[model samples]
Target: MKLTRIAQLGAVAAVAALTLTACAANEGGSTAPTSSESQAAALSGNLVGQGASSQQVAIQAWTAAFNQTNPDAVVEYDPAGSGTGRESFLAGAVNFAGSDRAFKVDEIAKGGFGACAADSGIVEIPAYVSPIAIIFNVPGVKSLNLDAATVSGIFAGTITKWNDPAIAADNKDATLPDLAINPVHRSDKSGTTANFTDYLSANAKDVWTWGSVEEWPAGVVGEAAEKTSGVVEAVKAGEGSIGYADSSQAAGIASVKVKVGSEFVEHSPEGAAIALDASKIEDGRTDGDLAFAIDRTTTASGAYPVFLVSYLIGCEQYKDENVAALTKAFFQTAVSEEGQSSAAKNAGSAPISDDLRTQSLAAIDLIK
Candidate 1:
């Protein structure tokens, strides 16, 4: 798969940062290592990861926390889009990957993760969970109530006006302007798009006929932006504009209250966690793989159906032992209580539950 120029540039930056970190670790030390660094310094190497712009803030927090104990171990992550990140991992361009989605059963069956030894299993942990907010910018509307059908219709280019009857019916309290609605989508292949499209496919199939996809479907016309930030920026710049992004990145923008059952539910970290708890693991996966099959059609009260379960993906066994060790340590730190709290505080993402954390650590332990 061909990476975009931005992704290519990010890859270069990741390598450069790794080189710089290694150089710093090897510098003639007049200064002593800090307590956090010297406590049990078993790890000392660079771990480069790529993928998922949505997890950028969380990744920042995770790397920071991981560096505290393993100061000699550098973790450099690039916020490339998910598809590019997965491709990089499969090509062995990066030590591990952070993706908004896990490798599918079919893809794993093909068995070509270059970082891993032949016949080795992979570890995929749901490390980040966040609601996908339906954000919009309208002249007078601070927020609007929308069902799956209305949301799908608006994005599918069927609902072109801000004052459409479908939208008006959902929000009787607001004065929606008569402006034309501009729907924006990710120009790059994105896990956010996949999750949003999956929700529409599961809940509004009649209107969203394109099915679940990472790329914007061909001929489904809309304004296209490069990443989550791009989509958010597009929506902010245009009047009566609508887009979807991880809730952590949707601050300062008006969002939709999606109808869960009889009541409309606003997106929240707690609500995302509830929806995730209602989801089941994908069947027939290896012990280390924990890919979730989210139930986007769920009508459970207080559950936000639209959410992304981003994963930290690595091999159960790697071609390089040092790579395996760094991946294990970093993954352990990411799923730890302190790590989750850091992410929650920094990114507004939902922390994985204790049961999930236990499972994640168990999977990470398999790395060697």
Candidate 2:
């Protein structure tokens, strides 16, 4: 799928207006009571964030929406990969970070101001939800069904042809081509890579051989691109090319449906929501650290098990009160019903369930 190029001028202007309005709202206070008051109270300054190219669509929506209401604040997010985002956040180069995966236990152990809070630890809330679409660009085939093994085999360079029996068996009705299958992968250490590898490891462990890792595993390899955009572009330019990316980013590409169990399911916001709803929160974390143990192998009828839950990581407290306020406001808006819905529309991502939304708001409260 190709990434849409919307003009940034209008988006930037809209965001600027939002920043001003948010600052005024924070200063003047509102007589009207609303469910998002806490979020409003935390609005006031500029914020810098970086991470997750997979969440680019959702993040752009979020920034644009937040700017509409908080016109006085500025929030800039760089769509770097997950690894770079984590590194920047840990180094305190950014006020917050967007990541597709949660921080490792070792990262938590490293004491840092942003990593640690006054009373609680840092907050990692799953805010954006979208399926990792298995996108393809093949001339003759418009649709295909790929099981976990076939997917792993293709990316691992084991299955090299478009007419492999395994692939043909899944798409018997369609005309199969004998073209060489060129699989694309992420060159950087990315959470998207982690999610994809995790699915392979969990479902096709025996054949895959490699376990999930942040950096791509050594044995299984393919042509690698730097970011989600790079992978999308590569797939678009090459015939018989296949790659996995966030569903929203696959705008003009043909995505393959995967057989989750007995059903062949296409990636969708509703389907991603089903998988997220089936997940449970991770245990043994502090109050401020809101991590989840996502069950990616869920076989629920409508759920796409390969969905990605992009997290918003923030410090519990900021040295600058204005920065704290801005962070809180941004987070509150992100977890709000309106905000989540906006994201759904602009990014093709699912909003968090009410149960998770309630918990997420409570976690944002700790950001002060």
Candidate 3:
């Protein structure tokens, strides 16, 4: 799969940065070794990773933390969309990828991932979990709870005004405007779209006919932005606009509280953790391939239904021993409690549960 020009530039810059850092380290005569160089030495080479713009904030934090501990190791991840990340991983353009979705059954059957041992299967571990916030820019509406149908109607274009009865029912006390509603969506092929669509499909199947897919379905219409930041910006700029984005990216915007079972639940780190706890790994797959089958339709109280678990997709074995070691080391840190804590500080994402952590660590040990 071909990468967007922006992603290609990012990959080039990452490699160049590593090259310059190595040259500087050699000139300094400091055998103590810088973190980037040490990682490079450990991985025996430079590492390139790309995919999942939804995890951009968390990835940046993880990269910074990993660099501090392994100075010589140079690792770069570009926040391309999940479709691009998966394509890059399958094409052998990256050492690993960060994605919101696992590889499809067909892709696995075709032997798309070269990183796994023959029949060893691929690893798709959910390292980051967060709520998909329904952010809006209505001037006075700060808090709102939307049931499944109302949300489906707004995005489906059937409900065009903020003062529509469906919305008014959810916020009976608030003064909603009669202005036209603008619904913003991601223009790119995104895992955010998949998660959002999955929620809609599961909860309001009659209103939303689209099945869960990375690319938005045809005939389903809305204003489209290229990334989570773009969608957030669009909503912020347009009055009466609503958009779906990773909760961490919904800065300065009003987010909607979704109705869960019997309560109107606001999205929080705790709520997301509850959702993860309610999920289980898919039954099939080898021990090394840590793919999970989350129950998105779960009605577990206190759990936000819009929760998304982002995965760090990587090969079980790498041709370069150093890359393999670096991948394993960085991932080990990521799955650890310390790494999860660091991510929460930097990105406001939900940490993996202790149970999931144990499973992930055991799976990472099989990476060799």
Q: State which candidate has the highest TM-score.
A: 1
State the lDDT of candidate 3 residue by residue for 299-360, as single tens digits. Answer: 78898878788888877766666677777877876776656765676567899888788888
Error of 3 at 315 (Å): 1.1
Candidate 3 runs further than 4 Å off: 1-44, 114-120
| Residue pairs clashing, model 1 | none
In model 3, state the lDDT of residue 185: 91
Q: Which of the two, 1 or 2, has more TM-score?
A: 1
Q: After superposition, how far is residue 39 of candidate 2 from its true place, in Å?
A: 6.3
lDDT of 1 by residue, 1-368 (tens): 33222222223333344345546657855444332333355688778888999988777776766665665776777777899899998998987887888999999999989979888889999999999999999987888999999999999999999889999998998998888998999999899999999999999999999999999998896899998999999999998789999987999899999999999999899889989988999999877999999988777789998999999999989989888878888788778776787678767899999899888888888999
- Candidate that would win on lDDT: 1
lDDT of 2 by residue, 48-83 (tens): 888898877666666677665665667777787888
- RMSD, every candidate, angstroms: 6.7, 5.1, 6.5
Runs with alpha carbons beyond 4 Å of true place in candidate 2: 1-43, 113-120
Report lDDT (CA) for all predictions: 0.85, 0.78, 0.76
> What value of lDDT does candidate 1 attain over all alpha carbons?
0.85
